[model samples]
Target chain A: MADPIHQFEIHNIVSLGSIGGHDIAFTNSALYMAIVVVGIAALLVGASSSRALVPGRMQSIAELSYEFVADTIQSTAGKEGMKFFPFVFTIFMFVLFANVIGIIPYTFTVTSHIIITAALALLVFLTVIVYGIYKNGLRFFGLFVPHGIPIYILPLIVFIEVLSFLSRPISHSVRLFANMLAGHITLKVFASFITLLGGFGIAGMAGATLPLALVVALFALELLVAFLQAYVFAILTCIYLNDAIHPGH
Target chain B: MATQAHTEHPGGKPQFPPFNKETFASQLIWLAVFFIALYVIIARLAIPRIGGIVEARRDRVEGDLAEANNLKEQSSAAMAAYEKSLADARGRAQALANETREKLNAEADKARRSLEAELNAKLAQAEQTIAGTKTAAMANVRSIAVDTASAIVERLTGAAPAASAVEGAVADALKR
Candidate 1:
């Protein structure tokens, strides 16, 4: 069988100048991210420029994505949190597009890497903390304090709350990265079976076709997971923003 | 599928890469830079455009509704004016009809009074003519009576009675 981890090797696409004795190199993943960002910008701008009273299909898709993020924010975080709608919407689209693009035959799955997902989760964590502190001043640290607890158990409750608070970035990043990595690994394994079994005979070739069929089926399922991961990420961000805005409730 | 594998390393020791904190920090810096760029685009460009579009749409809808309400009110006012004019015409027609009836009534009353006065004058004239005719007939009757009595007295005593004697006899007969 082929080495599964070999699929995750980062290929340097462009080498820029060194920054502080470290190579500031750009890779295929960075290129794809840039492409996703540009594609989204063009889609939104082109879809909405017409501003038709009756929308075309592309416009309808753009509007649906907007309304989806808007509604999710309103429901999860209330009207005051609607200001984050565009940010959340862009994040969802970028991740969803990147995951879908990776499913193509020769594309790299950027989101399968822990580094990418961890960076995204870290940004969300920092935003929540920084914005909360900026808005509420010193009172933001009170998020670790649970209200309505018995005075004697306050210390234990604070400890648990702090632990859970620290775990958000790990859980958020792992959920996306693990799902993508497992799905790609499975596809790679099944694809290897087709090559290995085909060398034997006619029956071996027929058996190889079975793994090929399974790979096809799993590919379809992975598409759904890609979209779901993006949605899950956006909703979690909204929930975290809510905690920042109103900590106790 | 569980075939035996040969390894260069005899012991089952896992091979791992060196953990460099500088590399991790460099990755973190790149991630932070990318995140800041994304944040700037979201805050400055995309969201404001979307909000402007929404606000413009809302203003257009409200303006349309306001215009429709104004037109409805104007139509109602025009209908009210039309109704008022119709009522004014009906009032004028009623007043004209009452005036025409009064004129006819006054003309009829004047004609009746004139006819009654003419008839009263005619009756008084006829009564005066009847009194004159009775007076003439009385004179004729008195002359005839005198002539017939004188002729009878002449046949018995050969002379006619005088006018004064005749008058005295007549007056005495009327007294009896």
Candidate 2:
């Protein structure tokens, strides 16, 4: 059997020569990202085409998707956090679409890559920094300093808080990337086992049914995980943004 | 069975492009491009239209409620005004009836008083006429008595008597 990690390979589909000492080749990841973005656009645009007072199926899906993100933001970040609604909503749709599409038999999962998730997480991190500084000025540093701590442990707590705060993007990106990576790998492994076992005989084919069942169950689990990861990503973003808006506690 | 990919490829190659520094810049570029585009589309198009729908529905409902309340107030005011006018009309009718009754009563009283005065005047005149009649009759009775006394004395004594002495005898007998 081939390596399971090979499926995650990002190869150059359109090889563009190096620009500014950098390879500007278009990749499978890029294609899938475009697909996700286009898919999202098609959903929203198609759903809103009728603009019906009573929503049709497409419109209901679009509106429900919108309200889902909006409600998540409101619950996690409160009303003031709505200024970042577009940012948070885009992240959610992008990740969710990517995760769902990735579950298809041969489609690329863009969110499975650390670079993509990291870039997204970094965007949020930067937004928090810029917004927190702009909103609270020098008082934004209060995030590192927890209130009601004794003076003796204040410095230690501040250090730990600052470390954890700086590590947000790493953990956030890794969580999504790892879940996708692991789920895809396990599915590939079980699938290879079933195929390898099926080649032996009627007895081998019968034995293959166990792994086949597991693969089916795993696919279902991966689908659930896909949605869960996206939700977690969005809610975390809201929570981080809430910190940006109110950095005191 | 699925199409077997990478069957001849070496295992444990560690060719994960995500960690590869070569593709980071390009991926970042496209990601930024797609994200910003989506953000613009969502913020500019979808959310606002949906918000407008919700807001319009809310406004319509509120306007309907307000119109209902206004109609209720207007109807109640009309009902109150109708009741007030009905009461006013009833009072006026009652006043007119009372006025008519008082006027009739006054007229009846005047008529009764005038009728009583006329009757009293007629009664007084009748009483005066009765007294005059009684006085005349008494005078006739006195003269008749005097003539009767003179005739009786002449016939009994077979001689004629003096009229003045007979009259005095008759008046003395009447007085007794």
Candidate 3:
């Protein structure tokens, strides 16, 4: 059997040649990311070119996605926070497309890696912290101080809040990466079972079909999860952006 | 618990690659590159275009609504003017009709007065002619009676009686 970890390996698609000590290679994941970017551009352009008063199916879908993100931003951060809508929208689309593309029969799930999700979460975390500090200065630390707490319980509450606040990136990144990794691993394991059992007698092969069916069902469920995770990530980013804009309640 | 742990430790397990500095650095390097690329794309391209599209759409809708409202106001003004003109036309028609009725009444009154004057002149002329006719007939009757009395006297007495006497007798009989 092929090593399961081999599925996570990056394959270089375009050798941009080495720069300094690094290979500077553009991998399959990079190529696909480029594809996703171009695909989204083409889709939006194609959908909007008609600019019909009554939208077609594609345009309706595109507009619906736009309004969905816009409304989410407005509801979470209010109008003052709407300036971040485009960023949040793009993030939602990119992550959603990346996840959906990964679910193809033989594609790499980029989000399955801790490094990718951690980088995204870290960026959000750093952005909020830096912006908060830049905007509010030392008072940014006031975020840790809960208002109206009893003086005796203040210390304990502040400690808990600080710990929870520090765990944002860990929890955010793990939520996406773990879900993808578990789903991909389960799918791989079930696919392996079909082959392993098929090597036996006809009755065993027949039993293997059950796991195969389950794999198909799980694939559909994973597609839903892919969209859901992207939504969750984008909404959380909006929340974080809100915090940066308005640090206090 | 210590004795059981010792037995598990003695059992062989295959060694795997250790998590170390190099692995962490390489992961961080790749992550930094990915994040930089994403941020660049977002900041440079995707966000600007999305913002432009949203703003453009909003402006267009607002402009369209403003234009529609302006047109509606103009249309309402035109409708008001049309109604006023129609009312004006009806008022002129009524005024003209009233003037025409007054003119006809004046013409009718003039014709009636002329016809009444002509009828009064004709009645006076007829009365004068009747009075003249009655006087001429009385004179003729007196002369005829004198002539007839002369003829009767000539036949009865063989000589005509005096004309003056006959005339006086006839005049006396007419008076009586």
Give one digit per residue, the lDDT tens place, for model 1 in A40-109. Answer: 6666666667776556787667667777888899999899788777678767876787788878866877
Question: What is every candidate's C-alpha DockQ against the true complex, given to 2 decimals?
Answer: 0.08, 0.25, 0.05
Clashing pairs in 1: none
- For model 2, what is the C-alpha lDDT against the true structure? 0.87
Q: Output the lDDT of residue B154, model 2.
A: 85
Give the range where candidate 3 chain B is weakest over 10 consecutive residues by summed lDDT. B1-10
Candidate 2: residue B160 lDDT (0-100): 75
- Ranking under lDDT, best-scoring first? 2, 1, 3
lDDT by residue (A77-142, candidate 2, tens digit) is 889988988888889989999999999988888988888999899989999999999999989999
True contacts kept of each: 0.07, 0.53, 0.06
Q: Which stretches of candidate 2 lie over 4 Å from their true place?
A: A1-12, A17-25, A49-55, A71-79, A104-106, A181-225, B1-29, B51-68, B138-176
Best by DockQ, which number? 2
TM-score (chain B) for candidate 2 is 0.73
| Candidate 3 docking classification | incorrect
